[model samples]
Target: MAAPFSAVPTPFRVRAADRWWYGNCAWDAFGICAALHVDGHIETVCADCREPIVVEVRDERPDDQRLLFHCLVPAARWWADIVFT
Candidate 1:
């Protein structure tokens, strides 16, 4: 259970550096690319509709504008119950 990377399958996935990496969440997906400092493609599904979603990241910035990241729990409390967060 890596922080930005997951040991098991998850909705968030990143394809970068010629390998596939599973991410724990949306933020982590991008973090994987940022940490590697390489362009990446992210694949996931919309939570509400289950529709496929893809995002591209270059130079640590996401290319898509139709994306949003929201967290109900504040960043300070994320680690308290990370499994639920």
Candidate 2:
């Protein structure tokens, strides 16, 4: 008799372009931080900032892929809006 089936694993992996997009988003966020510092929007910037202030807590966890992408996207958009608009 054939063996019983188990839960199937995903056959495919994420594409290179997706990975690149995430990394690019992160870089854009870092750029936004610099822009905020320059543009005298320090208070609003603090509200938008995602970098953890508590050093130990920040260091304890390994990076999360989704959260990292989220952290980058809005911040980059914020800066881009400031510069171009």
Candidate 3:
């Protein structure tokens, strides 16, 4: 596990399309889950995925507002790359 607190901040938001791959299997999901865990906002990320194609995440927690402000921002370019490659 990473240290409880690190000198640098972790990226709270990441695009699904940035990580998405066609024919993605269990391994891919597991890898994504691990990455999300390190991000510290795991529950919100997972919850956003349960919806349709469009997903958004907004910070509801009062204390760590900065850390919680995240959304599954669309990565259209990444998705295009996945399709082309």
- Measured by lDDT, the strongest candidate is 1
Sort by TM-score, best first. 1, 3, 2
In candidate 1, which residue pairs clash? Answer: none
Put down candidate 3 lDDT per residue, 1-85, tens digits, no spaces: 1322223333222233334322132222223434444221222223445532222322322233343323243445534554232
| Residue-wise C-alpha lDDT for candidate 1, range 7-85, written one tens digit per residue | 9999998999999999999989998998788999999999999999989898777897777799999999999998788
Candidate 2 TM-score over all chains jointly: 0.18
Model 2, residue 46: distance off in Å is: 23
Local accuracy of candidate 2 as per-residue lDDT tens digits, 50-69? 44321111222213423332
**In model 1, what is the error at residue 57, expressed in angstroms?**
0.3
List the pairs of residues colliding in candidate 2: none
What's each prediction's TM-score?
0.92, 0.18, 0.18
Which candidate, 1 or 3, would have the higher lDDT against the true structure? 1
Worst 10 residues of 2 by lDDT: 1-10
Instruction: Quantify how close model 2 is to the true structure by its C-alpha RMSD in Å.
Output: 19.0
Ranking by lDDT, best first? 1, 3, 2
- Candidate 1 displacement at residue 9 in angstroms: 1.3
